[model samples]
Target: MSRPQLESDVRSAYDEVADSYADRFRSIEPEEAIDIAMIEHFGSLLQAPKKVLDAGCGAGRMLPVLAAMNCDVEGVDLSPGMVRRARRDHPSFTTTVASLTDLPFPDSCFDGYFSWYSTIHLPDSELPLVVDEVRRVLRPGGVALLAFQSGTGTRDVSEAYRRHGHDIVLERYNRTADQVAAALSVGGLQEVARLERSAVSPHERDGQAVVIAKV
Candidate 1:
């Protein structure tokens, strides 16, 4: 499928299960301590009163985490329904409906960029463009944190939502830490740190990874 079609499908799938998704993942879970630690490390690397963008911030779950770190955080997601839930759930932060490939922000405006399990929907061929857009919106020395399942190939993740009574088709494309690091490097960002951990939770089907980069 084309990139546009893929994006549309992702948006629609998420929109269909926005409420259930939000209810299930409104906060950080204990199983995600390592992942949350990586995010905290990313927040620590930044200066005070940081301007952060939570790219593809579903339900704005992590917005509070960033805010607690003295960050002036805003969010953007491709799904309007997700954005709406984000705004309703976290009214203090701004959430907009926007695409990762085409962000609605000015150049070099953010001190930090966060994409927590958000890029898993993008195929390998389209990662560079999204990374380039990430580079565009970050200032010199800005930090970026990306969290996703680590592996190779795609998986049908729609069953998770189907179990909650929503029928949606969702495909998640997995990539290695090196693959993501290379994409960031090509987008003018340098890899700063990376962590890959084995899956521990019952819901997890693959290992997870967090890549921290700087522009």
Candidate 2:
């Protein structure tokens, strides 16, 4: 599929289920100890007053996590419905509807960046564009934490929403840790650490890979 069309379809699918998505995540978020630990460690890299961006931050889940680390954090997502839910659910937190490939922020604006599993729906061919954009906005010595499903496939996943009765499905891509690292390197990020583990949460069941890098 064309990039623009793929982007539009992905955005619309998430928008269609934004409310339920946020509600489901909020309930299960407390059980995400491993993700939280990694995020907390990422936050510690920047001191108070340094800024952070939660790229593809659906429903502003990372707000309080980063807040506890004493860093200013803002979120952005491509789905407008997701952004609206984020604003409604976390009134104090700032969020906007913006694509990862074309961020609205200036160069070297953030001291750290977090992507979590938000990039799962992005096509592999376009990953480099987003990575370069992330690198462009990161300050020197900044850290970025990226998480993805550890596998290879381009699958359309509309069947999972049957329980919710939403018939919502969209195309998603999976990659190996080496693929992610290579893309980050192409974007000028230096690899620092990596973690691979069994997927303990319901949101994803495939093996998970998390990579830490510095700019």
Candidate 3:
């Protein structure tokens, strides 16, 4: 499918289940200890009161995580319903409806970029565009942390939502840590650290990978 079509599908799917999604995943769970640790490490790399953008921050669940690290964080998501939920649930921070490939913010405006499971929907051919946008908005010496399912191809992730009584088709694209690091490098971000772990929960079907890079 085309990028536009894929994005539209994803937006619609998330919109249809925004409330349920927010209710189901209100916080980072215990199973995500390693992922949270990486995010904490990413926060440690930045100075206090750092300006951070939570790119594709659905429901704004992770905003408080950044806030706890003394980062001034705002969020943007492609789905308006998700943004609405974010604004309602996390009113302390500003959340906007925007796409990662075409952010509305100015250049070099952020000190950190966090994309937790956000880029999983992007196809390999389009990952660079989003990474370039990240590079565009990050200041010199800024850091970015990306989390996604680690593997080699796409998977149909619509079943979980379907179980919640929502009829949606969601496809998540998986990439190896090396592939993600390479894309980050091509977009002018230097890889600093990476972690790849096997799935440890019954809810998870694939290994997880987190890549930390600096601009």
Candidate 4:
């Protein structure tokens, strides 16, 4: 909530290094077995052309997974460069530049929503607006799987990147699982499940939070 610059920082930061980011995250890793399994489960639960939105889908990390699952998926990112790389990398899919706090789609436009490691950049003050936007874009009974780090405060990953000779970026916001669930409920989504896993790296929180909900 402190830095309103985060919104603009995210876009400029990502756009400046989209190519490098895309090259790095063009796909998921093999050691991410558990993570991939969760994604697969979420994708399998939806039918073909069910209309799913990949909220903040940077460089199209979930493109292949969702495509194989047969869900009609589209991606939206705050950085135009990320959108361009995603489209270039996954030509079969459609990608656009849009903000989660203010999505571009019409009301009740999608049947499912997927946001993996995206909202980590949003300040708490902005999280509710995003949740409300998600609710507005979902049809009745529409499902959503949102993921983020589990903890409090924010991490300035940009400094770390700069030290590593990489481009700077925005802070990663952390929140408890309860915080996410309560916000979703207030935004008209009912939490159906909670998934947690120990953080695989020291840079992460004690664990991660993935909340599954439905309208």
RMSD of each: 1.6, 2.2, 1.5, 2.0
How many clashes does each candidate structure show, in the order listed?
A: 0, 1, 0, 0
10 residues in a row with least lDDT, candidate 4:
24-33
Best by lDDT: 3
Candidate 2 per-residue lDDT, tens place, 1-215, comes to 34423778878888988988898886335445776667767776664456889888888777767777787889999999999999998888899999999999999989888887888888777899889998999998888889888888765577776578777657668788899998999889988877777767565657888888889
Give TM-scores for every candidate, taking all chains together and pairing residue i with residue i: 0.96, 0.91, 0.96, 0.91
**Candidate 1: tens digits of C-alpha lDDT, residues 91-129:** 999999999999999999999999998999988888998
> Residue 120 error for model 2, in Å?
0.8
TM-score of 3: 0.96
State each model's CA lDDT, in order: 0.90, 0.81, 0.91, 0.82
Task: After the best TM-score superposition of candidate 4, give how far the Cα of residue 138 lies from its true spot, in angstroms.
Answer: 0.8
For residue 51, model 4's alpha carbon misses the true position, in angstroms, by 1.1
lDDT of 1: 0.90
Q: Model 3 over residues 116-166: C-alpha lDDT tens digits?
A: 899998888789999999999999999999999999977888888898899
- Report the lDDT of model 3 for residue 16: 99
Q: Which sections of candidate 4 miss by over 4 Å? A: 1-5, 167-169, 202-206
Ranking by lDDT: 3, 1, 4, 2
Off by over 4 Å in 1: 1-5
Please list all clashing residue pairs in model 4, or write none if there are none: none
Give the per-residue Cα lDDT of candidate 4 at 94: 90
Displacement of the residue 1 alpha carbon in candidate 3, Å: 6.7
